[model samples]
Target chain A: MEPGYDLPAMIGMTEADVQTPALILDLDALEANIARMAAEARAMGVALRPHAKMHKSADIALMQIAAGAVGVCCQKVSEAEALVRAGVGDVLISNELRDGVKLARLARLAGRAQVAVCVDDAGGVAELAAAVAEAGTGVRVLVEVDVGAARCGVAPGAAAVPLAQAILAAPGLTFGGLQAYHGGAQHLRTEAERAGAIADVVGKVRQTLAALEAAGIAVPCVTGAGTGSFRHEGASGVYTEMQCGSYAFMDADYGRNLDAGGAWTSPFRNAMFMLAGVMSKTRPGHAVCDAGLKVMSMESGLPVSAREGVEYVGASDEHGTLADPGDVLRPGDRLRLIPGHCDPTVNLHDWYVGIRGGVVECLWPVTARGKHF
Target chain B: MEPGYDLPAMIGMTEADVQTPALILDLDALEANIARMAAEARAMGVALRPHAKMHKSADIALMQIAAGAVGVCCQKVSEAEALVRAGVGDVLISNELRDGVKLARLARLAGRAQVAVCVDDAGGVAELAAAVAEAGTGVRVLVEVDVGAARCGVAPGAAAVPLAQAILAAPGLTFGGLQAYHGGAQHLRTEAERAGAIADVVGKVRQTLAALEAAGIAVPCVTGAGTGSFRHEGASGVYTEMQCGSYAFMDADYGRNLDAGGAWTSPFRNAMFMLAGVMSKTRPGHAVCDAGLKVMSMESGLPVSAREGVEYVGASDEHGTLADPGDVLRPGDRLRLIPGHCDPTVNLHDWYVGIRGGVVECLWPVTARGKHF
Candidate 1:
């Protein structure tokens, strides 16, 4: 089925004519970011698997594939199903899946694409094996070790060995090595802190690899890294695959990350914007915009204004209050807002209006939006 | 168009068989809340126009209208259009519309339904008049007065007169009285604070009405009140309409609100839940659920767990971390999570699995889930 309405913009319209509270993509910057990441991954001798969880657009995924990305990484089976249906040939379910229905769906989806999933428990491995056997499909399974992020995965070193052995013993499943990711360490404020976190992650991954080797299991690939700390992982000589998603569309939260010189990292530019229109300017020092928490996720933080002297102060359900001390904003004025976080914010919209040279270039559907199951 | 996939669950399926991270509604609690609000509105001698911006479901709006509501209130033109297309007879755009494209759409939408919109500027009045004239349709225009929420609306009292007069002078427009809403007042921690804020709102609305009366203008309806402070507005003797939306599906944020006796309010029960499945249980005192920020909004706060000894602590893109102090949760275990905020949380899913007697009875689409433009 298609979306309930038309696309947010046409192919030839100007940016000014595009609808408010729409996701706007800078096409020039997006292409540059994609090319840069591909080149960097090649230089580091690691396979690039851009996470589709950030953009959720099949068109962008195809572009990354054409630019030498191995495949895309998604978090859920439904998301992988959407992307696979849209011709994303290879997908990695980066997190664990324990529900039987989802496992069955994943097993069926594996028939259409090269599908893999991560698991930290033997019970999950058994359930996945049953689903794959029922569907008569072969699927890859990765042993997820808790490198640093304490939220998911089993304990790092020897804890990954049992899950690997379980996957190897299963008939329809293949051992796909370890999934080691430190989500919290990706957002460390300083480069030194981030490097230290990745150093710890590399040590844990090495210990897991030693345990697998001792068990006579040959590890194929180890994947885990994000936009914030991919450089460290790429240079570590241990990570075989990189799963960086948000590098293509940098956000305010990432913009706050510092480099070795104590300046904002220059590897990527902000390529996506939440384009909002001022609908109310009644208050003297404040103006209300059409974008709010419904249109853009504020869980990370409030969006940063692209224009100087105008700061986004607060957000409600349907309105964003701007601290426009200069009182320069008026009704119908459009503003490009840098979202605080890229992933959940992109999930809030249906389409992305790609613009270049101030003109609409393309429109892509967020194919995997709301596919959280 | 239909959604990209099939419904999460079929009728007659048990709650346990439904997909993870799906929106579940308790039909009994929903019916009770609707009946209670309808009776309260009747006793208060005011019209009920439940806000569709919260639920965004035509089925619920129809249920309210069937019970005795005059119509429904929405925050966007696209939202009103979606509801109207779904057979809702009447809708009010409770927020301002300044963009010409949206104004034209709203004007065209009025041709098929009883449509009204709020405005605070004379320029907005002119634009609405032009759009209505172009479409050859009439729409009701309410002068939005700044009653306590400083985000939108003009200053209260005399500031509303010129806009009301402009609406009277415009073609294809009718002056529909004042839109006086105190959004910030609704969430005040204490009952006394909410009452004080609403009292101030009543005073401002009263001043605006007196000014309009002095100018020989007749006010037809005074609209605005949410679930948080609707009691104060209902008893204010100034508000003619109450727009309580969350009362239909109470959330954790609203559950924190205190009554006059320093207890949780007893008027509404939580009728909605985000049904999730535990995907990982590797840690000693923690488990990861399939639902996270992508499935449920976390701007208001983390979701409240329905089961004892389990608390939703942190959320990433696709995983919810649960603090399971008793370590009772295991992989594939189901959970009923009360969302932090009802409105945006409902916006994250495509369908609502309505449960009655532990079985799925109905599946209602969130008709206006992403109609933010």
Candidate 2:
């Protein structure tokens, strides 16, 4: 219950000396992911603004920047503020802001970093403008165009022009570019389907860019793309920036995506892992672990046991049931779990005990882990 | 963003001044829920050990204790630790523990409070005993019987008797009782199914209790039951404590459960609301809000708009789309969203901006919000 009992001290050694159900980050794998994405973006001549929404840790953002990412994209103003405070120079809030209090916070963030936000409405543009004006700061604005994800964003092409115009007209706000992120296309399992999805997205972005050009407006940055479809977006000339987030922590869901050769070849290595301890084996064919629905995200799917011969079958609020391996797993067995969805799963924890070379390197606070607003 | 800002600095202010996308806890409704549950427990003559996994807040646990609950059940050791540190006297960790580190933590927890834990294996009993012996504390251990959930817990009847005996045989661990909680039964939809599910659970408990009694072992407590079927467990004469977590904050999923009259009647009032603002209204039929999958949990389903004529149809990582309430919603319009799942949704926030009478009265830290150990 007293959380700060250093795991190393309690266990009489370092983190590497500890067993499973611990959140471990392969620094090498993480760096490789960052480098690969950066190289891809550099080759494609697109800005690489990695989404901080995926990690929510400033440490990761700094690493992304160091790997030549243009900037970081934050989903919430609070997240942006946290990143900026952590010395992230540029942050694009790839989501709209309506609350005046949040808008004011956005303006403050703009003072510290190169702040840009996405707007899908004329009123949102005006509000951003007003907040920027009130704070006496210059903030950039992007018109969010709905490509295929019918979740947010305005209709593509001409519809986005007016919002861009409003943002341009608003005092203290500059028309930054377009946010053409098709979130749904990112998880299309098959390569052809993913390509087709992004192809449609690219066509929509092209039309939007043409419409803006016709209106005598320049789109400086058309940012969109996730780890799953970054290749498609990178190939498409319309997308100026790729907003890939999950490439850092490749999960089982993303790992299912097929490559061009019709074989499963994940571009990124699995870097994130949840270490769990076997809590119970009172049953003959099952052993219960200490991680469950609350510890891991079951939205995408249940976590796959990293160890061979172990199958994760069920989860309760606090306990996860693992199918018994042929060998007996007693109460003290440690299990490593590769989360199905890394983003939300990370959100469920307070600290990321960063382990490297089997040692407790550091514990990074999930600073924006629960920043819903 | 720097979260603490204007927006009517006190609770019970007009809705116009409240911040959007803030967690609003209706104290009046919460008190009513506590009272109603307490009254029901009193009437049924069952000890109510409300689960802290729902709120994960010590303040709420204290409130439940004040409302005449015997103790509180937590899903994780970290949560139990937090509650015990906050002065929650009788704490039951309704989950298994495998690692010596957690067992040590649990043992330390027993020093301050009446600590009871569930075990489904002999190895778990040994670990608990070792930790308790090391700490020089007597920790109570409950043999978790697998009623029907098949998630955790050992098999009922004879299978549970050995685990019970193991706990009793342990050096520093005392045989507390049996845990026969069926989580999946909580959302059975109809009253009959819910009752049937509890009946099945009760049968399993009866068998296990009989097995223990036949072996000349006295089962001190038979704790089980949830918000969905506490009444059934209470009436079954098999359970001593009811661990219902969600009665404090009834959600859309719970709202689907039917009463004896075959009418959908939620036992508790909807006390938790996610106050979100319409960030975009460029389209005719849709309005985008700043709250989405990352803010609100979508595992159960989309959050239902409290206001009539508005539907939360979809969500992106950071934006929730509300079907436009024709001619009523603008870009800055504030809306209250009743999350589909209150527990996970609440876990996604750091501060519960408790508002009363439309004003922000208190900002309580979700103390164990991300305690995913």
Candidate 3:
């Protein structure tokens, strides 16, 4: 659905044309964020492969590419398919794949885009090799190294070399470099802690690179870094591609991260908000809004009211109760809520209704919103 | 999408023939549950209007109607629209509406089905009345009484009367009875606590009913109750409708509720499971699966491994890490995961692939999966 196409026209326009419980993206803030990240990557001479998992919209992926991003990284094969269908030429799935159906989907996707995937085990390599061999297509395989996340990925250093060799020995797989990512360290709260975490990651990457070199293998791409630790990874001279996703639409969680100046300056501004309306104000201190647990993700924390002197206290399936409204908030009052987390919150909506200057400027379908499989 | 369609045919089986991690519904268990609830409602001599919000599918609504349920209750206008499109004749949105666009949508939906909506304030009533008048359709408006949920709905007793009178005075709106639902009481750990909470709710509903009767306003339909306290509400002589959606696909959270035998017996059996394969298991004491926070909702809690001896501990975007997998997991091993919460977990998937007896049987597209509006 395009902007103003399937949606109901604004019945009565207000200061903000759309009603509450609407997903709103600040286009100016978003562009500035893309430019800032692109400039940082350009300065460091490292390729910026922005992760599309954060926004999950092809329109934003195109904007990132237009801003000189090398490619967009997708977490799921379906996401990669959606991006490729949207005309993204270069795509890399930074997550491991083992399902045969998904591998076949990836092989089909590789026909249209420069598709690469991460692998931490021999079984995954064998599966990818089989799929690629059957399709008679070349797919890049990156050996993911465990930096600190303790999730997927093999151990760094000597353990990663065998995985790389296995990928090179596979029938139709190309040996891409390491995916050394520490997801936990990205939200370390302080610059020193983030830098310390990244330093440890850089040491692991160095060890893996030395092991590959000793074995007479050229490591092509060492890609890893998020919006929180992209600068550290870029300055380390290890990673060739930085996969930062949240830099496009910063949320309240990112706003808490500190910068080098120690003045709590976020690299990006809060650009996404769920516009909700005050549906009922029967009580004196509380007013219920249309947005709730269904509308916003409550994993990080509850959404903070963007308006002054208002706070979100609780949420149900269909309604969010706001606390301590300074004035009597009648029904139809629009409120902008800054989500605690952006990624999961964006996944909850079907459309990203872009609002600029209070008019319905554009609407972009969240093509990968419910692509869980 | 139906059973034995697309993927199921490719897998060469019916829904009853698929392996575990595939969502399965025992026809016997489901029919027994429907019959049990209908018998309870018939014994109580009250209308059984089951809520469609639990299972956003119209197939379940049709079954509820066949089991002697008067109508189905919906949480959103979009859900009601989908239900009506799927042939549900009568529907009620159990939430307040303030947006004119949504109200217009509701009025349009009323044209196809017997539509009713809850109102908590005068502004909502006025907008709904105007929408109904403009659409040239009569919509039943229920005055929602805040029966301890502390969410939407007006204060009990006289405060609800004015809203009821306003609905009566509206051009194309009829005043339905009070909506006295206590959502918080549904999840009470003990039967005694749940019954006690329902008792308090009954008092409030009685006050509202008496006030309306004294004012000579007809209270045609008094609806409220969830799966947790439906039995108590059915016997209370106040609530005429039971809105229980999760009974169709019982989850781990619901399994915690104690049964009538003084033992831990789930009221509804576990029917839904997320089938995920072990993506990486080369590490000791840990194995990662393809299902994660994106695939399954973790808000209620992490999904429990259906097989004995395996425990789910950590999750990332596309991976669920299982710890202490005592000889039950390896790469290529498939496991069924019982989700912590059924609603949000169901919303994550695009298709509910139903498998039974070790074969892929059916694939139901989650038609209203991401319908947040």
Between the candidate structures 1 and 2, which one is better when assessed by DockQ? 1
Q: Please write out the lDDT profile of model 3 over residues A1-373, one tens digit for every residue.
A: 1113135224324335474567788777888889999999999999999999989998999999999998889887777887788888889898887776678778877888899999988888888989888888889999999898888888888888888889888877999899888888878899899999999999989998999999989999999999888889999988999999888887777777887786343668778998888778888888888888777877677888888888999977768889955765778778889987788888877777676666666778787775554
Per-candidate DockQ vs. reference = 0.66, 0.54, 0.49
Error of 3 at B268 (Å): 1.4
Which model scores highest in lDDT?
A: 1
Native contacts matched by each model: 0.86, 0.59, 0.51
- Writing each residue's lDDT as its tens digit, candidate 2 over A238-291 gives 788899999998887887778777644355788888887776665567777877
Best by DockQ: 1
Instruction: For residues A238-271, write the lDDT of model 1, one tens digit per residue.
Output: 9999999999999999999998886555978899
lDDT of 1 by residue, B65-163 (tens): 999999999999899999999999999999899988899899989999999999989899999999999999999999988887878999988989999
Q: What is the TM-score of each candidate against the true structure?
A: 0.98, 0.95, 0.94
Model 1's lDDT to the true fold?
Answer: 0.91
User: Candidate 3 lDDT, tens digit per residue, B60-82?
Assistant: 78988999998898877877887
Give residue A9's error in model 2 in angstroms. Answer: 9.0
Q: Give the Cα-based TM-score of candidate 1 against the true structure.
A: 0.98
